[model samples]
Target: MEYEKLVRGDVELWKRKLMKRSSLLNRTAKKAQTKMNGLIPEKANSVITESIKKMVQGALFGSEYLTKTKAVRAATLEELDKEVKEKLNFYKKAAAVEGAGTGGAGILLGLADFPLLLSIKMKYLFEVAALYGYDTKQYEERLFILYVFQLAFSSDQTRMETMDKIDHWETYKEDAEEIDWRVFQQEYRDYLDLVKLLQLVPGIGAIVGAYANYNLMDQLGETALNAYRLRWFNERENGQKQEKQSGL
Candidate 1:
């Protein structure tokens, strides 16, 4: 009963967060992202678009496949989250270090931060999924991780849309649109633009990079935890319904 109460409280907090509206800063950041993208040469933009699409796909299908699945076990939500928090912290620190290293360097080295940060995020998600007792090696679960990514980094409109799909995922998963990687990359870039753009500057780049990467990882961790929590609660509800119907 206590365990259920704790999970319920967490879900409530997550609800408030998801329903919260975007701020002026968020709107401005998104606009800035769009403008920055516009500044890129069309040919270069196309090249990047393709590159991001392939990079994301590779992350989705790659490491998780080679990883051993966690043995299925029964544990309370708190126990699960305890482990989850540890992993989140571990990844957060790692991302911060990576960000600081790249950001402190000149422009040429700072450019490398993108793929490195992406790998950290994807690898962390896979670990989180495994901790939550999900099998990332499965195609659908890996796809679910992408939705979680969308939920974390997308603009408000896109985030809500992605949230709905994740909320009803068991049913909605089958029909979820083939993620438009073009849009995916756009929103993601826009979301990161404000902080990441600053990371290109000379003196302050390191500070911005470390702070930004730390927060980004934190955001992703929250999204992943709540998403899996939603799944856990829904499964519990389904189990209860079945039990009552069976007069257990």
Candidate 2:
């Protein structure tokens, strides 16, 4: 019970942080990205969008093959949280290593880091879903994973909209259209462009790549954990309400 209370408190605090207004730095960066986006040719934008869609589709299907099924034995939330944290540690190390290896190899290999890192992130999310006792094999669960990914990497305005969908996911999913791949790819690219560009530089690429990937994993891990926490609490509340209604 104490652990539950602590987790609830943490979730509340995370929610507050999530809903906060963007800092001046973030706004400025977004404006620059917008200008850059406008300068890109429409054909190139389309190509990039299609490429990202395929890459993400590949990761989604690939991760499903690798992800474990839901735990057979039920575990307490604290136990699940502990295990998830351990997995997050492993993933952060893995991402850092991958980033450094690619970065140190120069431009061509650095380009390879994009798909590799995306794969690692998606794989970790699949594992997290399983650890939280969800079946990633379900289509809706995989869709939820994408929502979590978008929430973690989008601009403040997009993040706010994504969060609202995540908060009311049960209702939203009933009529949810396929994700806008154009928006998905653009936002994701915009979020990582600066750091990833630094990763392509010759001399300091290794260090930059490692540090950036490690921190990116940290951010994704935290976002995934809290997103699940929100689901956990929501489900519990719904179950309680159902039981009370039945008792009446």
Candidate 3:
């Protein structure tokens, strides 16, 4: 009887120890995850994207100041043009660097839609972050992100509803294949915004951004082929008051 009692006591003690250990482990994991998340560029990304969304929305709705300040408006328009041009150059160079054939360049030429694509990229990034439990100011950003994520994860039958009628998921898949995960990791580490948010979690933000960038281009052509991407881009900018009211 004594032996049985002693055995029972031992079992109880073991159970207590296990409970304590489990509690400690959970605490440690939570702390680590928080620390890691702190390293992501989420804050800066959020701030910059929110600002961009606001600007775009204002331009769309015809803000009084924007209309009144001809110089500011002109500068803003010039900036937009410059951005489109820069993105065009980047796409051309990126395609060249990636060794995309004449066919790829042709597609890009047909799709020369940076105004649309930029707006989409900005809004999509904001939205995807929201879906992943990130916060976004512009509701449109949220919608854009959903579109991209849906496209990214979708099976063929469902995609046609949101994006352009072009069938480029397979092409996106190909471009995604060319990503150097190692280089991406390094670049992710180097990204200042991510460095701040995901300080402990290292490469998560980079992986997300790289994958998004590569895949965004997968379905759309470079500026040479598809200028219609502008509609998608400018749509996000069309709702400034809505963007502000929605926290964007």
- By how many angstroms RMSD does model 2 differ from the true structure? 1.2
lDDT of model 1 at residue 167? Answer: 83
TM-score of each: 0.90, 0.96, 0.23
Q: Candidate 3 lDDT, tens digit per residue, 1-248?
A: 46435534543453243233235654464456446656758766466455545544543333222222121211232333444445444543443323222213433422332233344434333322322232344344333333443333222223333344222332333333322222222222222232223312333433333333454444332221122233322333456656888994
Candidates ranked by lDDT, best first?
2, 1, 3
In model 3, how many backbone clashes occur?
28
| Tens digit per residue, CA lDDT, model 2, 1-248 | 99999999999899889999889999999999989999999999999999999999999999989876464323688887888889999999999999999988999999999999999999999999888777787788888999999999999888999999888887788988889898899899999999999999999999999999999999999999999988888888888999999999
Clashes of each: 0, 0, 28
**What value does the lDDT take at residue 3 in candidate 3?**
42
In model 2, the Cα lDDT at residue 116 comes to 98
How far out, in Å, is residue 163 in model 1? 0.8
Ranking by TM-score: 2, 1, 3
14: Cα error in model 3, Å: 66
Error of 2 at 197 (Å): 0.7
The local distance difference test score of each candidate is 0.84, 0.91, 0.35
TM-score of 1: 0.90
